[model samples]
Target chain A: MIEAVDLERTYKLGDSDVGALRGVSLSVAAGDYVAITGPSGSGKSTLMHVLGALDRPTAGLVRIDGRDVNTLSDGDLAELRNATIGFVFQSFALLARTSAVDNVAMPLLYRGMRKSARRKLAVEALEKVGLAHRLDHRPNQLSGGEQQRVAIARALVGDPKVVFADEPTGNLDTRNGEEVMKLLGALNADAGVAIVLVTHEPDIAAHASRQIQIRDGRIAFDSAAGRDPAAA
Target chain B: MTVLEGFRVALEALRANRLRSLLTMLGVIIGVAAVVLLVGIGGGAKQEVTSQVEGLGSNLVIVVPGKFELGSAPTVSRLQLDDVDAIARVVGDPNAVTASVTSGEVARNGTREMFTSMVGVTETMTTVFDRPVARGQAISATDVDTRRRVAVLGSEAAEELFGDVDPIGRQLTLAGVRLRVIGVYAERGSAFGVSRDGEIHVPVTTAHRILGTERVDALVVKAPSSDRVEELRPKLEQALVDRYPGEEFSAVTQSQILGTIGKILGLLTLVLAAIAAISLLVGGVGVSNIMLVSVRERTREIGLRKALGARQRDVLLQFLIEAVMLTAVGGIIGITIGVGGSLLIDTFSPVPAVITWWSPAMAFAVSAGVGVFFGVAPARRAARLDPVVALRTD
Candidate 1:
């Protein structure tokens, strides 16, 4: 579960102040599938960053699994990110020149896993993404779609309670994008992991069980199908 | 992350840029090698000098005529035969002392001619220098008393002048005066850059009559033992000082000369080793510079790792290990080449070179130190980078 209360994020660009998040409040219950949709510079990415504990808010509170993220130290935040949340970036931010299995095993490296044990888990994660045969393939060697799958495998290898995908299909073809979306849907349905996806495309947002539209750093619309809107 | 994982990451990064890694290691290699080689040769030279001093016989005290400054030639003082006689009289031993006057001479036998120096000494010179004549007999004390026109040739000088013929009975013209060779010294090798087998020896009285000099160049006194030599130094100095009253001369023991030479050579080696360490510093800077560039290039990767749960200390350790591994590799290569080079020099040249085990070990430690010292800046920079901004970097 995740919660935010009037979250605000302001960045200093040279001499001027640019506010990315302005008084945004939202919550997602356990095992929920939510999509935050917005245009460019609309603060969806900033909200995802704050929720994932990657960046601290300029003001207000962000609690992930009941722990105040802003109150944690940098090390604690990293630990929380490692054990509680997983991120799938738009560009498939897998390490270049590293094999797919090795890249997937990278998160477990921080957990102090042995190489053999990490490799074993990485193989299983890769198998779940239909990349069992491409364990030794590097990012450049894999297709854009395959790379995204590798990134997804890396994210889920740690079995975090929540997954944040920021435009996971941004760089993929339509068919591969559909496949990735189907995989995320399957992960939410079978594993009961909360999935929070940020995207600009309405079609991508439509796959989620709940949709929240953000504008000018504030929640503009919140909808939950077959569920109470107040609970979303 | 574990230290092993950090090392693995560093190794992977370095292997990806093999050429750059080797180039970065070059500075440390040269630095460590220079230090090892210089110190090795220095140690060898000190050993050689020690053996050479020991070869001159134990309990020997050399009194040179003049005040001498380091790195400057000795100035001639009024050191006559009185100083030599006084030393012997003070020591209460008639055969304990001998004086030598050296002069450059042109030695001619038949059509062969050679330019060489001649030393004038009494028969006790053989015992003072531990030199026994290889053939015939040494110049006796009676030769000095009678001023006999007899000469003793060093092995090399004898070989040059007499060829395969017997040199003990042959007559050689020295300064246009004919003197019969009475003895030939055995083969004595060179030491401290001075040739021991190139000089000719004659009686002191004969040399004084021929070369027209009443003053000897230097004096040698033999003490009962080496320990007593130290006790006798002041007595020898006082006796000479009393005789001359105003002249300055130096009475130095053989061990003292060895110690002085050893100290100078040791200091020289240390200075050279230090100069070589500067290159190691430069090498460390090279590592730091390259590591900085690596961090910049891998900003996104760093961000991804942070996102994957790598702590700031993890990033720091990764970069630091990378830098240390570079220097360590360089340090090892340098030590190998340095030891090999010193052994090669020792095998091929007359100049002795001894590679001590500690030199390479110390050099490696310095290289590692250089790595850590220069690596901290870049590692800290890499560690302090924000994961958010780094992830956003293209």
Candidate 2:
């Protein structure tokens, strides 16, 4: 689970200050399938970066799996990310020239797992994504859809509390995009894992049970906010 | 990640770019080889010199005119036959003393002629220097007393002048003096790069007349034993000093000469090795330069690893290990080539190369240390990269 309270992130772009996330507040609970949609430069990626413990916020606080992101050192933040968070980038970001199994088993390397055990767990995770037969294939050897599925297996191999996927289907064709979306849906439905997906496409955001639209570094709407009885 | 994983990752990275890795290692290879080879040549030369001096007999002491301190003008010797007698009395062996003057001259037999070293010497050499006449008879006491026109040819000189023909009892001319070859000296191997077999020996009495000089170049004394040389050297020099005050007569033994030559050769070898180490230093710089380029090329990988929970220390260790491994492996290749080269030189050339154990050992350690010394900046740069920025690099 990830929670952000008025998280603000600012970056310096040469001569001027660029505010990526301006007072954004959001939270995702256990087993939640949430999508944050925005145009390019809407700060959706920045929000995810802060909430996933990858980037420190310029202001406010973020809690990932109950540990305050502000209170952790850079190394401690890395360990927290290893234990509680997983990430999937649009490019897949699998190491070049590495086998699918080695790529999937990468996160567990941070967990200090032995090679044989990591490989076994990676195979199981790949099997969940229907890629068991392609364990030894490199990313360059795989099609876009298979590479995304391998990326999903890498995200799932750690058994993290949540996975942050930013534009997961941005580089795939329409058919491979549908396949990746279907795989993410199947994993969510069968395994009760929380996912915070960032996307710009409407159809991609439509797959989530709850959707939040971000415009100008702030949340424009939340699908579940009105449904919750606790929200006045 | 484990150290094993660090090595695996580094090795994989290097293996991925084979040519780049090899080029990066070239500097270190040349550096280490130079260190090994230059030092080996120096050590071998030292060994050769030591053995040659010992070959001349460790009991040998020579009293040369003037001070023998390095790099200063030597005092001239006015030594004569009386000095030989005085040296013979001090050593208490008349046959062990020989006073000789060496001159470079053209020796002729028919139309065949070669430049040769002609030594005008006392007849006592046959008993003292241990070189025997291989054919015919040696210089006798009568030969010196009568100033005989007979000469003993060295084996190489014999071969050069007469070829397959018998050299003994044949006519030979030295400088312009007509003489007969009475015998041929046995083969004696070279010493200090000059051929011993090119010398032609005539009685010292005839030498004074032909060379037109009464002064002996130096008085050579062969003591009864090595211990006697040590005992006799100072006494001989003191006798000379007592006989002729204000004239410095330096009496030196084989070991003293060996010590001086060994020191000079040792320093020369060290200087050469140091000069060679400069290329190694440049090679270290090359390693650092390539490592910097590699770190830049892998910025995204560094970010990804950092994102995957690699600590700064882990990243640092990975790159450092890669660097140390690069230089260490290169160092090994260099040592192999250097040793191989030394052996080749020793076998195929006149330059002797004696590989000491420390040259390779020191070379290896220094090369590895060069890795550590030069690797720090690039590795730190890698370790300090931000994960968010790194992962975003294309």
Candidate 3:
């Protein structure tokens, strides 16, 4: 399980302090499917970054599998992100010149696995995303939906405890977005993997079992927790 | 990451920007080639000089008056004919010794005059040095004992001064002193740029009268056996050194002369190599500049690698390895060109050039070290970047 209590993130922009996340708290258990919803600058994306261990919080605490985020060094944080969770970005952050299989095998590369061994796991992950035939094709050669599928394969290749998706289908067409959503549904339902995604679409938020809404750097609403006292 | 994997990624990155990488490597190539070629030319020059010294004669010890310190002119010639007799007694053959005092003078025959080395020598000159007479007879002991005004002309000197007419029995004037030509020396070719066949010889006793100097410039003693030359050198040196305790006499065989010449050439080669290494340092600076640009250009890639769990050392090592790979490949190409150039020069040019085994090897090592030394700053900059900010760069 992953947990956070009153996490706060602030940035200094020349003369002013910009608070991206202020007193936001959340939790997700094993096999849970959750969606965080908000408008632009609502701190929903900032919440995901902090929870995914990509950015350090300015205040409060975060724990993944009972280990405090504050206790880890930068290198330790990177290892935790690599071993315990996977991230899927809206931009499909795959190496441009690399083949789909090589892109998928990148996470395992950090673990010092043999090239052949990691490639074998990559092939299986690509098969799950219906990208087995496109293994040797580069990111530029693949279609938008195919590239997203390759990104999905990369996320699953490491066999992480949970998958964090920040606007995963924001760049896809209607049919492709539905297909990617369906893939997430099956991954959660059949494989018992946890999924936490950020989106503004009400329809996308409706897919998850639990929903949380962030507004002005604070948690405005949670379907499970009802209305927050601090919300505007 | 594994070393092999680092090399793989480095190779990939360099291939992505082939033209820029090749341009950066050009400096190293030129530098290494210069070093190797200069060293080769120096080595070959040394070899040629050694061979010429050995070819002159064998088992002959050249004894000169002075302290005999290297790189200094021989100090104050005080040796005389009596010292020659002393060496002759030690060698157990009175006929094995010869003395010479030489100076440049005009050899005038009738209205014609030419500059030639005027050599004053004892009668044993031809016999001790194994030089043969082409015509007439060599100077005998009677010639030196009686102080006769007779001379011998080197083949080229005789041809140039006497022309088609036979030089023997002709009168030639040296230093305004008339002398009868007794014999013509056989042909001995040039050594370095100077001709050995342009010298004119007379008996030491007569040279003292004409040149007006009693001091002998050189005392050459022929050892009985070639094997004894090494042992006899010190004995002859000791005999003369004992006679004049404060003065040092040098008695050296042909091989020792070769060694001295070799050492001078070796020093010249080192100086040339040092000058070439400065260019190599400039090449290293070029590599550093290009690598800095590469680190900036690939900031996003660095962040992505770190996000994928690459540690700071891994990122540092990747860039470092890339820089080293560039210089190392340049070094290999330079070596090939350098060795091939030495061979070409040796074949097509009169200037001797030989590729020694160590020149290319040293050049290669220096180029690789250049990579390690210059690659550090840029690689460390890449490693120190904040992954969060780096990932956000456009």
Candidate 4:
């Protein structure tokens, strides 16, 4: 479970202040599938950053599993991010020149796993994402959908409590986007792991069980929706 | 992260940019080689000078009778035979003193006549200077007592005067007197470009009688041992002052020559090393510049590593290790080339180049220190980079 109470984030631009997030508050329970939809500058990404402990809220508290993230030290926050939450970026964000297995194994390296153990775990994670054949292939060598899948496998390798995906299908084609959404959906349903996905496309938002629309740094709409197979 | 992981990452990064790494290392290589080679040449020159000075005899002291004054005429005071006897008495040793009177332009054989430096010395001169007879006998006290015109021909002087003939029983004309050569001295190699074998020797009394001079030009004093020179020098100076009232003379000891030459050569070496260190500084600058560029290019990589739970210290250590590793490798290569170059020069050239053990160690230490010194700014810059900004940099 996560909670935010009246979060505020501001950026200084020369003489004026740019509010990325303004007085926003939301919460999600365990094993929940949530989608955050917004326009280009609607503060969806900023909210996700604060929720994942990457950035601290300016004026309020953010709690993950009942612990105040803002009170944790940088090192403690890093540990939390590494152990309790995983991130999937829109660009895949895999190290460009390294293989998929190495990319997946990177998070475990900081955890002090042995090289052989890291390789085995990374291979298994890749297999879970249906990317076992592409384990040795680098990001540039794989298709867009495969690369996204590798990123997902990396996210899952840590066995995190929650997965945060920011525009996971932004760079993929329609078919690849659908394949990635199905994979995320399966991860949520089968593994019972919570997922907070941020997207701008309505069709992409339709994959989640709950949709939260943000407008101008505030929640515009919060509604539950059933997954429609035909729409997907 | 652990040091092993840092090393792995650094090695991988360096390997990925092979040309840049090699170019960066080139500066350090040249710096180390310059330091080693320059110091080697300096050390070799010092040894050469030391050997040359040592060849003059380790216990011998020379008292020259001249007052050296700047922009003024030198007073050529002659030392007396009593001065040598008095110095010997003051030194508390009977066999420690010998008087020398020198004359130039003494011709021997007509066809082989050459300008020769003829030295007239007491019987103790040969033994004090460690000059042993090579072919025949040395002069006796009887020859000095009788003032006989008996000469000892140095190896070069004998060859110049008598050619292939045996010169032990031959007569040579010196200062218009016919002096029989009683012995041919052994060849003493050249030192400071002065050949001892090019001179002729006879008794002091004989030189005074033949050359029509009563004044001795110098006193060659040999101390009981090398350690006694310091004690004997002031005593001899004081005794001479008492014997010849109102006269001044300088006693030049072997240690003075060694110390003076050592200081001068040491200074020269330090200057050369300082200049070489400038090149090392330039090399360090090169490393810093390249490291800055590398940090900039790898900004995203740094962000990713930090995001993956690498501490700031880990990032700093990784870059620092890369810098030191590059310089250390360069130092090894440079030391090899420098030492090999010195050896090659010594083998093929007239100038002797000696490589000491400390030179290579010093070169490596300086090179590594330079890397650490220059690496600080760039490494700090890389470590202080904001991860969010770096990740957003694409």
Better of 1 and 2 by DockQ: 1
Clashing pairs in 2: none
**Which one wins on TM-score?**
1
lDDT (Cα, tens digit) per residue for candidate 2, span A1-232: 7788988899999989899988888789988999999888998988888888889999998988888988989889889888878788899888886899998998888777899999999999999989989999989999989999999999889888788889999999999999989888877788888888999999999999999888878887888775422244
User: Over the stretch A1-232, how does candidate 4's per-residue lDDT look in tens digits?
Assistant: 8899999998888999999898877887888999999898999988998898777888888998778987897777777777878788898888876789999988887787788898999999999989989889988999999999999998889888889998999999999999999988988999978999999999999999999888888777777433322245
Model 3 spans with C-alpha error above 4 angstroms: A10-20, A37-45, A65-67, A127-133, A142-146, A167-192, A199-210, A229-232, B44-59, B65-67, B70-93, B101-120, B133-217, B223-256, B350-359
Model 3 is docked with a DockQ of 0.47
lDDT of 4 at B87: 79
lDDT of 3 by residue, B92-158 (tens): 8988999999989999998888999998888899988888889988888899999999999999999
Q: Which ten residues in a row have the lowest lDDT in candidate 1 chain B?
A: B65-74
DockQ of each: 0.77, 0.61, 0.47, 0.39
Indicate the worst ten consecutive residues by lDDT in candidate 4 chain A.
A223-232
Looking only at chain A, give the TM-score of model 4 against the true structure. 0.94
What residue pairs are clashing in model 1? Answer: none
- Tell how far residue B330 is off in model 2, in angstroms: 1.4
Q: How well is each residue in B100-190 modelled by candidate 2, as lDDT tens digits?
A: 8889999999999889988988888887778899999888889988999889999999999999999889999998998899999889878
Which is the better candidate, 2 or 3, if ranked by TM-score? 2
Model 3, residue B383: C-alpha shift (Å):
3.1
TM-score of chain B, candidates 1 onward in order:
0.94, 0.95, 0.85, 0.76
Interface RMSD of each: 0.8, 1.3, 1.4, 1.7
Question: lDDT of each model, Cα atoms only?
Answer: 0.88, 0.88, 0.87, 0.84
Residue A155 miss distance in model 3 (angstroms): 2.3
